[model samples]
Target: MAEKKSSALFVCLGNICRSPIAEAVFTHYVKEQNLSEKWIIDSAATADYHTGKSPDRRAIKCMKRHDIPMSHKARPIIAEDFKNFDYIFGMDENNIRDLKRLAPKNSTAKIELLGDYDPEGPCIIRDPYYDDGDEGFEEVYQQCKRCCQAFLNKVS
Candidate 1:
């Protein structure tokens, strides 16, 4: 039998910051663990604020510092994402709630807190959009890395 495709969608208020970073982090983790064949990881925003832009410079720089390449373009999460993604992870409670609201009643079960996978620290991965410097970017990157690892462990 063919292997099933287990997909995940990471979401934030604006795709330019947290969500894209989560996408790259999670995708990198899966590839590192040799689980790439079983998963299709991606990301989106609950809002369209940066719909056509690349990830925020700080986010890109953080990923580059860790040698992770991010190829996803910012986009808004649509209703059909609910059907295409097996799991929907939100960077914060607000994004989760927004995605849940757009989810088809039957697809509501797929939405979850991104931090649900990270039980030890804070549950919400803070947005670095308003940060004054690189410090917040590094913090977000570290948290995203932890969350990705936790997610891989659970799915593996």
Candidate 2:
């Protein structure tokens, strides 16, 4: 039989910032480990405020600096997503609560905080949209990198 591709959906309050970065970082990390072909990666938001909008400009720039190409449109978490993804990672506790609330009782996705996978640092991927400059964005990138690496190691 053909091998099944594991899928992951990264999420935050809005898709523009943290979630997209996490999605991009995880995608890049998987490719670096030569497991990209075995995985399906994407991102979304818990709210529809930025639906259809592109990832935040700061996030785009951060990915550029890392030489990781990223292109994604904002979208809210949907019921179908609960069934489609094998894993759904939220950036913070609020996201986890919202996702749990939105998910159907029979939903198959394993919902959890992405930061929980971090070996070091805070267990929350703080929102940087309101922060000054790119420092917050950079920190998000670093956290995502660490979390993604650790998460992948445990699952794969």
Candidate 3:
């Protein structure tokens, strides 16, 4: 096998919810497929609002229901991320636009909407904070699983 090549960055506004769940689900799914070594994967926020915080408990609980563990902490996107990650996936358009503002000039990082990978078409995962429920997290988690699976198929 020619060495597989890829690196992915998941992004959201706060990094305390959606993005973290995406990171956990993608990491778990790729590992189970034994393709973890082929790619670099991580997550960050478009805003610093929740920097240094752990994922929201609601999100953690939701992911746990799916048997996915999320031990990763939240961090805001850094200048280096625009250079380091091959792909930067945002939880929604607003996050994507915000991240674009921070991206380096002439950035080659492939910024995208995470849901674009959803077979369901360009739908954004809803934010649960507004409603205080895991329903949103669960929906995003399922989409992340499908997307990551599709990504692996394309890359590996």
Candidate 4:
């Protein structure tokens, strides 16, 4: 029998920072565990702001520093995403609110905050787009790494 495939979508306000990092971190973890074939992971934005753009440069640098690869372009969360993924994790409260608002009535995905899986504590993954330094991106990377690790452990 074929193995069951689980899917997850990470979401943030613009998709150029936090969400992409989360997606990459989760993907990295799955890959490291040799479970990539069993997982479908991606990232999206709650708004159309950065659609079609690559993740912010700072995010790229932060991910690279940790040896995580990120190649997803920014895209807006669509009603179809609600149907495609088994789980949908938002980076902040606003992203969750927007996702809940946009979720189709018949959608089957479970929506929640990614930070809920963080072992450190349940906290929001704030956007780092406006930050003038790399610190915010670094923090985001750390949070994503911790949450992704914990989430993977739970699902494994």
Cα lDDT of model 3 overall?
A: 0.83
TM-score to native of every candidate shown: 0.95, 0.97, 0.91, 0.97
Instruction: Give a tens-digit lDDT track for model 1, residues 1-156.
Output: 998889999999989888898899999988888888899888999988888889989888888999999987899988888888989999888987788778876664488888877757798898889988988889878888888898888878
Cand. 3 TM to true fold: 0.91
Cα lDDT listed for each candidate: 0.86, 0.95, 0.83, 0.92
Candidate 1 local lDDT, residue 88: 91
- Candidate 2's C-alpha runs over 4 A off are none
- Model 2 local distance difference test score: 0.95
lDDT of 2 by residue, 30-134 (tens): 999999889999999999999999999999999999998899999999999999999999999899999999999889999999999999969999999999799
Which of the two candidates, 1 or 3, achieves a greater lDDT against the reference?
A: 1
Worst 10 residues of 2 by lDDT: 28-37
RMSD of each: 1.2, 0.8, 2.0, 0.9
TM-score of 2: 0.97
For model 2, what is the alpha-carbon lDDT of residue 21? Answer: 95
TM-score of 4: 0.97
Model 3 agreement with the true structure over 39-121: per-residue lDDT tens digits: 88899988788888999988888887888888878898988898888899987889878988899896778998878777765
Ranked by TM-score from best down, the candidates are 2, 4, 1, 3
